[model samples]
Structure formats: structure tokens, C-alpha cells
Target: MLIFLDYFLLFFHIALTAFNALGWAFERTRKAHLILILLTLASWTVLSPYFGWGYCPFTDWHWQVKRALGEGPLPGSFIKYCLDGCTGWDSDPVTVTYYTAVIGVVVFLLSCGVNWRAWRKSHHTQSSEIA
Candidate 1:
């Protein structure tokens, strides 16, 4: 069961990360993308002082499962772990963290911009109809 959970979390995290990055592109997912990106940013910034920078509860739980599965000491960044596993490249943790942060912020801003534009469009349409 633990192994099953480990795999579940691995794929789930990957999918969530991908969604957080690109979900804003779809009209159906823009709102959810904004919320998820905000949560991700909060996890990285608001909770950083208490949990350290870029802290994610999902990552924390996944790490616990991995540790229970007898994995040796894992890297601090989940992205780093995934990159190393997928590409067989032992990338630097600092570089991974920096890129992860930059990409995350960029995605967040994109999500906000798209959502705002969408909201403004709908709001204008509604006002025009009412008039």
C-alpha cells in the first residue's frame, strides 16, 4: 500500500505541477488555475518563514512516504528529483530552486493576467447587455 501511495503521489504531484503551469491557457480552467497558483505562491512565500523557502505540504507528505519506502536521503526539491530521475542528470539543487521559483512566479503572473482579462471581458459583456 505504501508503494502504491508513493506512485500515486509521484504522478499526482507531477500532474498538479503541470496544471499549475499551464492550466490558465484554457477558458474552462482559468479560475482554478489562478487559485492553485495563488496557493502555490503562498506555500512558497507566506509559509516559507515557518517551513523554509518553497515549502509545499504535498512535497512534505510525499517525502514522508518516500522515506518510509526506504529511499535514501532525497533532494530538497521535488522538481530536482523528478528531473534527475527522468533525464539522469544530477542537476544542482540551487539552480533547480532558482528556476523553479522564477517559473512559478511567471506562471502565477500569467494566470492572473489571463483571468483578469477574462473577467473584464465577461463584465463588459454583461454591462453592455444590461444597457
Candidate 2:
């Protein structure tokens, strides 16, 4: 049961990270992308100031599960963690965090821009039809 819980948390963290990075590419996930961007912004602005710049709630919870299961110290960056697992490369957490932040900002802006354009197009069409 505990092992299963740890794996579940691990999977959740990975999926959420991927979704955060690439969700904007799919129209069906645009809404989810907006919510994720807001959540991530809140985490960075509101929670990070209190917890730390690289702080992530999902990662924190996942680490807690790992510790409970007797796993050793966890990696600081989620991207670094995944990369280390796959390639056995030791990555700097700070560098990974910086890269992640850059990617996140780009994706957030893209998601917002795409959604805003869609909203405007729909509104314009509606106004034209009403005339």
C-alpha cells in the first residue's frame, strides 16, 4: 500500500510537470493550461517567497511519501530528478530550475495568447452575427 502510494505520487508529479510544459499545444487542453499556469504562478509568487523559489507543492508531497517509504534524500528539481533517473546524469538543481522557469514562462504566455485570440475571434463573430 505504501509503495503503491509512493508510485502514485511520483506519477502524478511527472504528469503534472509534463502537462505544465506542453499542454498549450493542444486546443482541448487550453483550459487546463490556463488553470495550470495560474496555479504555477501562484506557487512561484505566493508560495515560493515563503517556501523557496523552486518550491513545488506536488514535489514536496511526493518527497514526504518517499521519506515515509525509507527513500534517501530527494532531488531538488523535478526536471533534474527525471533526467537523473533516465540518464544517470548529475544535474545542477539551480540550472534546472532556471531552465524550467524559462520554459514555463514561455508556455504560459503562449497559452494566454492563444486563448485570448480564440476568445476575441469568437466575440467578434458573435457581434457580427448580432448586427
Candidate 3:
């Protein structure tokens, strides 16, 4: 189970990261495309728990296994925090707030950089024409 989760996360992250990265690679994304990227990030974060997410969801899933099998770090006779959502850790609200913020800023910056370059070129052309 843990191995499977890890594989899933890796594949999803790589694909989505590449999707957004390449979209911004050639040029700055238009307002609509930028919004779509933001939405994708938000969707990943908000549905992370249900979808299994983060830089290492597999690690977390393994932790649960160790706890159940009576391993270290968990420090308990039994029970695990691995499946928080299913095991009643839902009260704490498993929100991916941090990643959402990080991704949002990153996406926004890329958008700004692209727009800035385009604007600068336009301005230079206009100035040259006037001269």
C-alpha cells in the first residue's frame, strides 16, 4: 500500500509539475492560463488527503504501517496516524495550506515575469518608432 501510494504521488507530481512548467517555459502565461494553473494547484492541495499528496505521501503511509506493526517513532502500543482522514484525524482538517501558498506565489511570479518581458519589448519598440 505504501509503495503504491508513493508511486502514485510521484507520477502525479511529475506530470502536473511538467504541465505547469512547460506552460510557462516559452512565454508568460495569459491571465486565463495562469488562473487555470492556480486552480490546478488548489485542486491538488484541497483534495490532497483524499487523493493522497504532498512531497512524500508514501512516507506518511509507511509511518502508519510501522505504527500498526509496532515500530519506532510512533511510540505507542498500537494505532497509527497514517490514515488520518479515515481514522478520525479529520477533525484537525488536513488542509494543504502551505503548498497552496507556495505554488500560488510561484505561479504568480512566473506570470509576472512573462508579462514584464513582453511589456518591455513593446515599450522599446514604441520608443524607437518615436525617435
**Which candidate has the top score in lDDT?**
1
Tens digit of per-residue lDDT, candidate 1, span 9-117: 9999999999998999999999999999999999989999999999999899999999999996898888999999999999999999999999999998999899999
lDDT of 3 by residue, 36-91 (tens): 57666555567667764432343355456555655565411111233342466532
**Per-residue CA lDDT of candidate 2, range 33-55, in tens?**
88998798778768876898867
Roughly what TM-score does model 3 have, to 2 decimal places? 0.37
Q: Per-candidate TM vs. native? A: 0.97, 0.94, 0.37
**What do the candidate models score in CA lDDT, each in turn?**
0.93, 0.85, 0.53
Error of 1 at 129 (Å): 0.9
lDDT of 1 at 15: 99
Model 3: clashing residue pairs? none
In model 3, state the lDDT of residue 48: 69
Instruction: Return the top candidate by TM-score.
Output: 1
Error of 1 at 112 (Å): 0.7
